[model samples]
Target: MKTKINLIFPMVVMALFLFIGHTSAQPAIITQWTFDDTIEPSTGEGTASLIGGVTQHSATMSNGWRITDFPEQYVGSGTAGAQFIVSTEGYQNIVLDFGHRSSGTMSRWAEIHYTTDGGANWQVLANNNGDLTPHDVVYPFSFDFSSVAAASDNPLFGVRIVSIFSPVAFNPEAPDSTFAANTAYHRARTPGTGGNPYSGDGNWRLLEVTFAGEAIMPGGAEKLTIVDFNGGNIPELNVPFYLTVQTQNINNEPTAIEIDTEVSISVTSGTGSLNGTLAQVIPAGEHTLSFSDLTYDVAENGVVLTVAATSGMVLEPAISEPFEVVYPLENIIAKWTFDDTTEPVIGEGVASLIGGVTQHSASIGSGWRITNFPEQYDGSGTAGAQFMVSTDGYQNIVLDFGHRSSGTMSRWAEIHYTTDGGANWQVLDNNNGNLTPHDVVYPFNFDFSSVSGTANNAGFGVRIVSVFSPVAFNPEVPDSTFAANTAYHRARTPGTGGNPYSGGGNWRLLEVTFLGEPLGILPGDANCDGIVNILDAVTIVNYIMTGNVHPFCFDNADVNSDGLIDVLDVVGTVNIILGRVRK
Candidate 1:
């Protein structure tokens, strides 16, 4: 009597939801597969199979179905999993529940991922899973697809459980592990035994795979409304912008806004790639959802976005007003990719080894290696690499480069600059402000825009040199071995039992670059001939009187700084030629 009452009570409440309300209801079973006899779903039309280069076969398990022959330890994370495909045409707030049991030798981490467009694309349910404890005979796992708008009603919806790397717990005493390709979080121990490696022969059994969701019942007509990008402002290329999508009735009232629906965005007309998460679900009781980090890579005059329903909830697709995407104002002045030789690949610059450092012909991080330094900490402020370039017509200069250091090298590097050629050099930031380069290639950036005489200078040079410890040493600190004549920061910790610091350790550079915004157009240079004279005045007059076009820049004809090309602008250009006004 007790079991009958518990099951009957929920069914009665679900029946009341059918006629009383359409927006809110309890989730009902959409599909289920016990896999008791075959690999087909028992409750709905779908198929299940093993994927990702793993051998599979059916066998008698303690309960339902089982498969053996998983990937070897630490080799194939994300390359093996079980896949299930089904249609969710009338469902919202979809949820998945499953039971898994793994052998002690199997990987302890698994991920739940899904695809909306068949198998063409897949997205992970971000940061949802953890270490799969092996001691449990049947571990139940539940994932809420309610927030993933793309997982909701589609013919090609599919879900999979893939193995991922064994996670490591965080500890402040030890440095974090270097990131590998498919890392996970939260480490787990083997069943009964403490720590064991994952093996290829381990067995994994699965059962009671079920999917449930709130069924959409039709009543009021709904429409999807897509807000324009950045409220119709011109967006910069590759810069992220926010967008909003809402579901409402034909009258578009706040009370009539539809809830719990999934909509997808598509590029109606554009040449570039539309990036970031393109689909999101409206919350349970909310009508609008925002995707805050959307971006387009190429500049286009007409980029139109359309939001449409993958589920049958919305009647028509909502179209956005066409908007322009413009290029970022900053442009690269010079770039060097030292693939085979240390030479500038773009623009003009002279790059060379400096302060007794020599170039090695072997690939380190970059193809060209700058090596053979002075004795360890001997060239504290005088040795390393130097680059001389002219920012003749550019302002707001920024320098960027990819750099790496060998284990034995000093990690501290100081940036020095000379504004009036190489006659006088000063560290860009004092000795205490040195940068620490890693063994793995990493980027370093310097902004010289605010420095005096950096812009429009024909004599600009910068250097990166090793530096000694600038701070007084204390024996209580972890780095007490560092002396005044030694590098303040060690690339590798001293007591870690790695290679010792030596002068032979080197630094490698790649993709060295200088970026700046071009200076404003020369005043009164209507022809853009790099000079302002009588010809510029004549050119301004010609444009105003006969509607003639300037050979170079029409904007230069507006010499009076007014937003028009008229006789007043021509008079302003004449005054500059006569030296009555500053050029």
Candidate 2:
């Protein structure tokens, strides 16, 4: 019967992003083929050889050395043994797809070697064959060409297929032939072959060997583009700032490519400094720098830049684009300003106001306050101002209030929140107690538990209403001291309220923490920067469909940690959008 060969397709998908520019323009193509075809004996030319009595045909080898029905076997002679060859001018990745067909054998060997100068010298590129018993072997094999040496003058390269039957051991007959003895059994030997003659039946068939060419499109030079800057300048003082950058493709297509790049900023003529590395997916369009605590004594005048590809790939000259550093005014005291016309009232130690009011300012005593409370301290209509505060789906809202007097005031504050734009509000937090003043600050905390809305419905503000005691006040206390009992709303976590004593000092409007999923209003809420648009959806889908997880997962893209992402997480994300679940 003619030799029977079965074709197996492994489950493997490979995707690579290449930066192409005019100087480094090179088209890449991935080649795949299995060496199972048979040719007549006379057809064997160059390195080709004949197998069995027939000309050229694939065969299932039972014994290690036997090439055909004759039974005469040939063992490996020296370091330069059996192999194949191919050419590489501008190649990036070389993929080998194969499957192991065995019952319960341990060791099976197959390796790919390349020679830069003809077949004279060969370097091992990859070696793969594991100890999986009853091996179904339905997985594609992939090897990155990043570690291999580049092809210079003689760009022509060839592949060598090395197959060894005998275990690696010192041979007494040919002492120099063997290196060391290996107790591990290799599947290359037949069962009946007495361990010496190399028996057992095993074969390695070349299912497919694909040489993927690199596609270096024009303008594909990998470089960093400064998109935006905070404070408008660098080398700024204790003032925090951010930087936005993008990675472009050869065709100038803004592809979300992550590059291992660095960023450093300094003054033009002055002496200020800031440095950091590019991390995670910079997205396609633009991104902002998350650096918040930078100090600059003088203004930034000059700027230096540098960049390089992670691997041996030589990036175009655009990698290092230098620009000037312009610094804005530095070091301005942050004080809370309030919109006085909004309220201007303080009832019997109680104040309440409607939500969605915008006329407000920062405060020195209170980070954010509602001005003009009812003159007298009594329970009345509306007392406080209601406003909305949202996070980029990364942080939660924490509100704190304090009564600074020795007066018994029955005080209380309630936090009403809604995922839908004020269409509904859920009571998140509430407080009630005596205001025995002596610089006492009570922190009312809300974890946004009910704020389980998508990034779309992430639009949420707070409606804060405080009530004070209706009792007599000690005349010893000054009126201005208790004139406006301060109340502040800050975005912070438990035990993380900065400068709580000063009330409004050092407080921020947004606090990005490493807890909870960034609010997902729609599919793309990967980084939870709070917009359920295309970017967010693409981030989630890419991770799920493709086995690539960029740092953007911190934005809520990694629904499950299965190493492989899928749509199941997207389903839960959809639930969050419907207000069915909170991330």
Candidate 3:
């Protein structure tokens, strides 16, 4: 189980173990310095030896010895090796940040050496040949255990700086004097040449040297602020920072635990608290602390506070752990309908009369009577009456008309559509002669493909109309008597395909079908029959010439099953067409 504690709350949860007494690891501090001037001798007496330096000078430290600008000629002088004792034994890495400030004509070089049995005999670990120029900020030279022999057992080492070729005498005591004379005249002089002195005179400055080692800290209450709300003026805070604590076991093996958390601040009015949360797994190792936040403010100018663990939590070897939360996208389909309650009679010629006619005696005799025809009726008009439909773009308009009575009327019902919000209309279906009386079970389909462009927009509508001949109607005729009472049900299509009666008239709206397989040919269906076969070849050719085939033409034409529709497929199609082979 994972528990999430918001960092914003003032009360921070302390690690359970921190309350009890437990020893942890100590943090490491890496520092570097460059020596360009002469230094005073050591006041305390000890075995002091000059490892390497200019003018044979020497500097002493509590742990080890360092020499600046030392000549290479005195490698094994009297008691020099014995005095320079190696102190860096358990360090894993070292960084040498050194450079020279010179205006000479000679190349400069540096080398690092290691000694196991005192300093009697030395072995070169690394060397640079004229690679670094004077006055250049050479990057910190990082040296790993790979450069040392049996590094785990012998981590102690020494460094040496040498001037390869130089005309000016080098001075470790006074670096500025050698280059000062040539300040105006020899500005373009190369290293180790006249105009700028080298060796004991000037032309050299050592920047910094640093050592990095591992340390561990354990047993403490880790109070981490992921975010802080300074005040109402600056309310929201979102910054992520990492705190790594080191821990060691009885065997002296180092283990680090990294806590990656964010601090956030939400301030209201003048009072605000900082809150934070953990969102990543803590890894084992010597963890380092880093922060990346755009809105962080410190009260003091140069007093950056370094936070440390102080409670129950102790850095130690343990399993990794993590923190996060997970959520999904939401959507819905809404629908609305316009019933007779709102639209009674749509227009002057339209009516919703039911069970009136089975046949046509007159154009307006029965069957949803249309008083007017074509806006103006001529001598027993043959045109039909119109009824309009409005939609809210979401619905696919489908005109459903049930065939209650069967007879050959002078005209058939058709549907018209308008994309311009009823500004103009296009006949979706004109005189649907293909529909037969027996086809009553299946609604007449007019795919909205013809009006998809117009209907895809905001406002769209449909108009249902029936064409009949008023002059052709016979009052005594049985067909005429029943024609006025043609009753049918209107509705929308119930599948994925477009409006089936898009071009047809005399359709009514019904419940929508939200889910269904869209009507079209499946992939590799060449014959346009939803399958691949020899007929597919003929279909391909027909499509190529007439631009009429199923949507997935490429799937059907690529006979070799490759993802391409090229000449090879054409040849394969030709072969299939000639009955040379089967698909």
Candidate 1 regions exceeding 4 Å error are 1-330, 337-341, 356-370, 402-407, 419-424, 430-437, 440-443, 450-452, 473-482, 485-488, 493-497, 508-511, 521-583
Q: How do the residues 121-175 of candidate 2 rate in per-residue lDDT, one tens digit apiece?
A: 7677755543222232322344555456554212455665443333455232211
The TM-scores, one per candidate, come to 0.44, 0.25, 0.22
Better of 1 and 3 by TM-score: 1
Q: Model 3 lDDT vs. the true structure?
A: 0.33
**Model 3: how far is 218 from its true place, Å?**
12
Candidate 2 weakest ten by summed lDDT? 505-514
lDDT for 73 in candidate 2 is: 28
RMSD of each: 16.6, 29.1, 31.3
**Candidate 1, position 33, lDDT:** 77
lDDT of 1 by residue, 254-365 (tens): 3233446677887999767989889876654666767788899765556898888776365467888888775454666777777576677677777877888888763423
Which runs in model 3 stand beyond 4 Å of their true positions? 1-53, 56-86, 93-107, 134-140, 147-149, 153-156, 162-203, 215-583
**How close to the true structure is residue 138 of candidate 3, measured as C-alpha lDDT?**
28
